[model samples]
Target chain A: MLEVKNLTVSFGSHTVVNNVSFSLGEKQWLMIVGPNGAGKSTIVNAISQGVPYRGSVYFSGKDLAGLKPSELARKVGVLSQRRFVSYSFTVEEVVRLGRYAYSSSIFSGRSDDDEAKIEEALEVTGMKPFRGKSVLTLSGGELQRTFLAQVFAQDPRLLILDEPMNHLDLVYQKQMLELIRRWVGENGRAVISVMHDLNHAWAYGTDALLLDKGRVVAWGKTADVLTNENLQSVYSMDVYDWMRSLLSRWSR
Target chain B: MSKRPEGFKPVAYILFAAAMMTVMVLCICAGSVNIPVKDTFTAIWNTVFDLPMPEDIPWSIIILVRLPRVLCVALAGGALSLCGGAMQGLLRNPLADGYTLGVSSGAALGAVIAIAFGIYVPGFALAGTMAMAMLFAFLSLVFILSITYRLDCSLSTNTIILMGVIFTMFANSIMSLIVVFAGERIRSIMFWTMGSFAGSNYVNAIVVFAALLVFGTAILLYSRELNAFAIGEDNARHVGVNVRKVKLVVLISVSALISVCVSISGTVGFVGLVIPHMVRMLAGPNHKRLLPASLFSGAVFLMLADLLGRTMLKPLEIPIGVVTSFIGSVVFVYIFYSSRKAK
Candidate 1:
């Protein structure tokens, strides 16, 4: 269980994320969709403690601000749109880095569970072949999977992703979503993803939060949040009509 | 071709250890006054065993001048490179080093002030100048980092480097003013700032080694955090690294190291930047390996560079800083080209 209570991120007089409050429970996947500058990613940044915000993010009824970095890491994992790595690190090494929260000291050896979790993450993400390959040498989609394996290995209770499907091909996009669905389906885990693709928000997200500028335009079940009126106000366009018209073209 | 994942190997370390020992001995023996190889070993052995003193030039050189200077060079070189590796990783900048970051100039200003005023403390291991140098160095690091955070919260490379350049110029201007008013102390100040091991003694070596032992351990302990840092601070945070705490601890440790080094031998640039790059290439980017390997490689590099400085012009010794800059510039150019092309 995770609760973000009235979280607000502001820079001087300019607010990026304003009074955004939401909760995520087991088996629930929440998608945050908005136009550019709507602060969709800012909410993700706030919840993950990537940026400072004037509010509270409670995880499993515990205040995250009071938690140690290692403790907080065991509860939340994030897969960002881009992973910054300029050095030459193998994919396995990158995945194993997720075990930092579990590891006590660098001098100590890895436990059986640590190794097993890493191996399973590698298998699930299909990054086994690239285990020994440098992260610098990976393709965009392959690199995305490598970091997905990293999050899987982290084994957190909640996963927060920012544009997880950015730069992914159609095939990889489907595979990554399927893997994430299974991940949440098994462990009583919850997820929050920032998505630009409205179709993906409809298909994959259980609940939705639509944002415009810095405020919430609509929130609740995906169907309710994506209604014609809600979409029109936020996007200022006939989104459902356009989608339905496009749907007719694909019909057999 | 894919590189096979390589982990810790005892053999590489064993060879590295041997090379360290061999290079140190060679450096000690091959100075302007060439001591015999046998005498060099014999002198060290007798001193270690506390046997009878040999009344010889070779023995005195090993006991008095060369040994202490070599020891100090090793400590300074190793610490400089270690800090460079950590800073580069933290900022995700290839060009980050003590000299480039303006920390050396700040420490140099501290040391210059101490030298100009003839500040010295009897009975204390670290002189008054070294203490001042460390303080100013840490302050400089804080100054630049806070400035970068203010300009850009991400601590991007360009902002950090710009702040560092401006700070270095400011510090150097103050140093030049000190030089102007220094009077008779100008020669010592210039020679020291240019960087040399000619003035090193046992006290300087031992004190610096103590500082390195304390702070170097701190940096080495944060190797995991540095590894995460390379992947971006947000990624590191999600992995449970306390970024603020790590930043505080590592910055303090690195500053302390650079201060002690600059206080001993003025602004030996590029050892930190170059050695870490080499270590990462050889042992991979895992900080666990890179940190220790940096210590060893940097020590050897400095010993050799100092040896070249002493013997290059025979009667006229080149400053150790000049020698490093000469070599560092070439290597740095290669790295600059390669890193840009990588993008």
Candidate 2:
């Protein structure tokens, strides 16, 4: 379980995220939806304690700020925006990085359990075949999936993913969402994802938090918060009118 | 494509260790006065085991003259290469080494000043040059860290490398000024800058060994953290590495280790820069394999280079620095070309 209270992030005089608050429980999936520059990713960063902010974030009833990074990492996994790496590493090796928190010492090799988890994560992401391949040679979508496998191997109780679907194809998109859903459904873990796709959020999210200009616009069930009026106001699009026009065009 | 299999690492390490042992024996045997390999082995075994000394062997030449120099060469090489591997991982730059970062220049400046001013510490067991070199090496490390910190972009290789370049320029200018006024001490200063193990004794070799054990073991403990850092600082943090603490500890300890190395054997070039890259090329980028591999390869490479320097012209000993730098530049160019081709 995770809780955020009046989280605010600012740079100099410009506030990126305002006093917004929300609570997420185990087995719940919260999708943050907003337009560009709407503080959506900032909220994820704030809650994950990756960036400096005012207010408090609690994980399992303890203040997130008080926990050491290695300690917090055991409970929460984070996947930020995609970035490039300078060195060449095998896909299996990159995924093994996720087990860093579990590794007892540098002198010891990975335990049998860690290897099993790595294999399972690779299998879950359909990356088992590429275990011996270099990450430098992977395509964007493949690299994205490789990192996803890494986060999965972390096996954290709370997963905070910022734009996890950025480079994924439609098939992988489906697979990823299904895997995340199962993580919550079967394992009772929690997931908070920042998403740009309203349709995906509506179909997959149990709860939705809409943010615009650093303020929370709405927070509730996905269906309740994704009404035509709310979509029109927040996204500046007449959803119903546009849908009708698109439907007419398709009929023609 | 994937690299050579991970199994290649242990094999490579064993080969390198064997090469290091062979080079050590050859270095002890092939000095100005040639002692047969058999005599060299007997002298070394008898001295190490403290058995009755061999009456027919040149015990003084083998033990006092050559063995200490060989040990110093190997230790300095290992220390430099380990520092290089750590810095490259820390800076996320494959080319990073003490010379590039001006840390070695700082130590050289300290040594030159000590020699020029005749500043000697009576109580210290090691040479005054070693003590002053350690002092100035620490100072240079502190200075570099301060500038990088003040720039507030420690993660950016461009900023760090640029600051290093500027620091090197500043230090070199001071060194030039010292050379201009150094008059009678110019030869000594030049020899020190060019690096050598000619005057090394068993005591200093032990000191270098102790430094390698302490600092090298500590760096090995941080191999996991270094692997994470090589990816990116933020990525390292995500993987539960305390990035700041790891960087600080590695930088300080490595600088101290290099300073101790420079103190005993002067500032050997390319052993740090080239050996790590060679190890990585052979064993891949994982620090667990790369660290120890670099250590063995470095020791072997430097001992060979030192042997070449001594025997190339016979009695006209070339500075070890010159040989390594020459080889290092060729390797640097080759790496640059290959990396570009990779792109």
Winning candidate number (DockQ): 1
Clashing pairs in 1: none
Model 1, residue B199: what's the lDDT? 71
- Model 2 scores a C-alpha lDDT of 0.82
- After TM-score superposition, what is the CA distance of residue B49 in candidate 1 from its true location, in Å? 4.2
Number of the top-ranking candidate, with TM-score as the measure: 1
Give me the displacement of residue B37 in model 1, in angstroms: 1.2
The digit string of per-residue lDDT tens for model 2 on B127-156 reads 687778778887897788678868875545
User: All candidates' TM-scores?
Assistant: 0.95, 0.89
> Which digits, one per residue and each the tens of the lDDT, describe model 2 over residues A119-140?
8999988899999888878977
Per-residue lDDT of candidate 1, residues A1-252 (tens digit): 988899899988999999988888898899999899999998988887777899899988998888888998899899999766788888998888898899887777778888889999999999999998999999999999999999999999999989999889999999999999999896569999999999999999999999988789988899999899998988899998999998998886
Per-model DockQ against the true two-chain complex: 0.64, 0.50
